[model samples]
Target: MLDSVRLYLRYVVTSVRSQMQYRASFIMLSFGHFLSTGTEFLGVWALFDRFGSVRGWALPEVAVFYGMVNIAFAISEAAARGFDTFEALIKSGEFDRYLLRPRSTALQVAVREFQIMRIGRLCQGVIALVAGSLAVDVAWTPGRVALLMAAIAGGACLFSGLFVLQATMAFWTTESLEIMNTVTYGGVETAQYPLTLYREWFRHFFTFVIPLACISYFPAQAILGRADVLGSPTWFQWLSPLVGVGFLAVALRVWRFGERHYRSTGS
Candidate 1:
């Protein structure tokens, strides 16, 4: 375990140092990432400005939702970038080599690449989180603070599971991965606001199928102590993020099956 940890650290250092060699490129890409996603937030701001609010959910409440999902996605994208590019590894026959390595394939793919530019996304998320915190006026108790952090972590796991699921699909299909973007990227956009505004079926899909709401919405309700919206039970709201871990667990199992299929085919 220590050796694996040390090796992953080496991978991190190597990724950072390589990017440092091209500082100008790194800066430009980071700026581009920040500017692009930041513009999308402006669109959300405009929607609220025009309509005043969606179903009584004011801007501040929406900001909290936005900030939470952003933080989750940023962590996942930054940490699981390699899974984001898993198709490339398969095409280049690199994934096969991974199976022969001492380290776990999942760990190796996770550290296969570190995208330093995701700092821009991380910065944007932090900015929204701070803005939300300032606007919402939640009573910042230690337990609430811990709950918020746990929610963010759970959301990240949910998103990473989506990404891994997307990667796993590549094992069977050689087609474009753009369709999966509908869920991974679309989920980010959808989760950026309260789930109440969405239709009932959409809400159910996110809740039971994808569980995006479980990661942020249901839990946000609990954090805000809101029982009137979806009317989910109080105890369930606090425990909803655990669904994210389940989502990730299922994703890994699918990934393992995909790996086995790939090995059998390669042989």
Candidate 2:
């Protein structure tokens, strides 16, 4: 495990250095990421501006959810760029080489690329988190602070799992499916606000099928000290973020199953 972690760190450092060699391109791409996501937040802000609140959730409260998911997803996107582009590896028969390596194939594939440009979206998330936390007037006790960090970590795991699952599908079809985007990118857009704002079926899909709400909505409720209309217990709300970790565990098992059954492209 330690060797794998060290290898991953080396991969990250190499990725950062290579990207930094073209600083101008890196800066512009990062800024583009930030600007695009900023517009999305502006739309959310406009909604709250038009209606003071939606379903009793004010802008500040909702911003917490927005910030957490964005931060989490940005981190996942940066770290899991390899999985996002795994189809290239399969198409070129590069994945066959991974199986021959002494180290874990999943680890090798995961560390194949580490995007550094995602810092822009990450910066935006931090700003939203800090500003929203201040405006929401929540008492930031030690426990609350810990919960906030845990929620972010769990969310990152959840998104990483989604990316792994997306890559795993290539083992069968040799092409990455577009439908998964509905659960991934779509889940990002959906989880950025209160789950209560969505309809029952939509909420159920996210809750049971995707469980995106567990990392953002439920944890945000605990952080905001708000009562859940769905009547989940406070203990459950506090622990919901861990569900992301469990989800990732399940996704990894599925990935292994797919990997074991893989028939190479035979370059």
Candidate 3:
């Protein structure tokens, strides 16, 4: 496993170096990504400026949510660029090369591409998280800090699962994946706020369905020492990482099923 990880790292570095061959275009694309996501943070700031709070959650609290979601998203997009753009892979017949390899399909698909441009977005997320941490009045504890890191890691896994699921859909049809975007991109947008801010159905969709909030809001409340207005037990907040794991498990199962279908149908 360690050797495999090292090989994957080398594969990613190679891809990054290849992408850097076009230095000017790469820099412009990276800057474009930074500016696009920076506008998202600006939108959040504007919302806070217009309204002191959203559903009683303060600006710093929402920033925590925004930062965590974006951080997870950037990490997933960078590492899982292949699965994230699986439709193109299928269309371009690149997935067939993955099948020819003896390595795990998932790992090969994961390392097939690496979006170095997303480093800009990742940097933005780091800055936002640090600034939000400074702005919030949370009592810092070692356990809480650990939970924050775990939450970010779990969220990244969960979002990667969503990307895999989206890619898996290519086996069936490749018209347009606007519907999956609701879960992938839309989930990111919705999760950047307290889960309790949403209505009952939306909260339930997130908790029992996608569970994006499990990685951010619940763990965040634990870190912030805030009460769960959504009536989730205190222990649920501590155990929220499991939700992301569970989502990933389900998504992987679905992806495997899709692979079987693709192999059988040759589509």
Candidate 4:
């Protein structure tokens, strides 16, 4: 396992260096990504600007949600770019090369591509988090700080699991991406606001089904010191992030099952 980790890091470094070969293009693309995702938050800001608040939640609180969710997603999208593009590898029969390697196929697929350009979205999330943290009057205790970091890490894992599952689908069929995006990207958009703002069924879907609410909403409530309008206990709030980690573990197990059942495209 330690050796696999080292090899993965080596693969990541090589990928980063290769991408940096065109520094100018990378910088511009990163900026473009920043602008693109930045516009999404702007839309949220516009809603708050006009309505003052949604379900008694102010803009600053929502900003925290926006920030954390985007940060988690950006990390996943960058780290899991290989999984996101796995369908192409399947179509081209490149995945067979991974099967021939001695290392874990999952590790090889993970580092097949690492998107450095996602730093743009990451920067945007940091800005939003800082602005929200400053505007909100929460007494940032050490526990809260730790919770914040845990939430981001857990959320990233959750999103990465989604991407892994997305890739695993390629072993069976290639047409499932659009549906998966509804869970991955759509979850991002939904979790940006307070889950209470949505209908109960939508809230439950994110909470129990995708567990997006576990990594974002429940933890954000604890971080913001707000009561869960849906009445989740405090202990549950603190421990909710582990749900994401668990989800990822399950996704990986599922990936292995898919791998064992995989057949080559025979290209």
- Stretches of candidate 4 above 4 Å error? 264-267
Top candidate on lDDT is 4
lDDT tens digits by residue: candidate 4, 1-267: 898889988998999999999999999999999999999999999999999998899999999999999999999998877898899988888888888988777888988889999999999999999899899977799999999999999999999999999889988887757788888898899999889899989888998989999999999999999888789999999999999899889999999888887853443
Q: After TM-score superposition, what is the CA distance of residue 13 in candidate 1 from its true location, in Å?
A: 2.5
Go through the candidates in order and give each one's C-alpha lDDT: 0.87, 0.89, 0.87, 0.91
Q: Estimate each model's TM-score.
A: 0.95, 0.96, 0.95, 0.97
Model 2 spans with C-alpha error above 4 angstroms: 263-267
Q: Tell me the tens digit of each residue's lDDT in model 1 across 10-101.
A: 99899989989999999999999999889988998999999988888888788888888988998899878889889988888777789988
Model 2, range 57-125, lDDT digits (tens) per residue? 899988888999999999999988789889888888888799888987778888788888889899889
What residue runs in model 1 are displaced by over 4 Å at the alpha carbon?
1-6
Model 2 reaches what TM-score against the true structure?
0.96
RMSD of each: 1.5, 1.5, 1.5, 1.4
| Pairs that clash in candidate 1 | none
3 or 4, which is superior by lDDT? 4
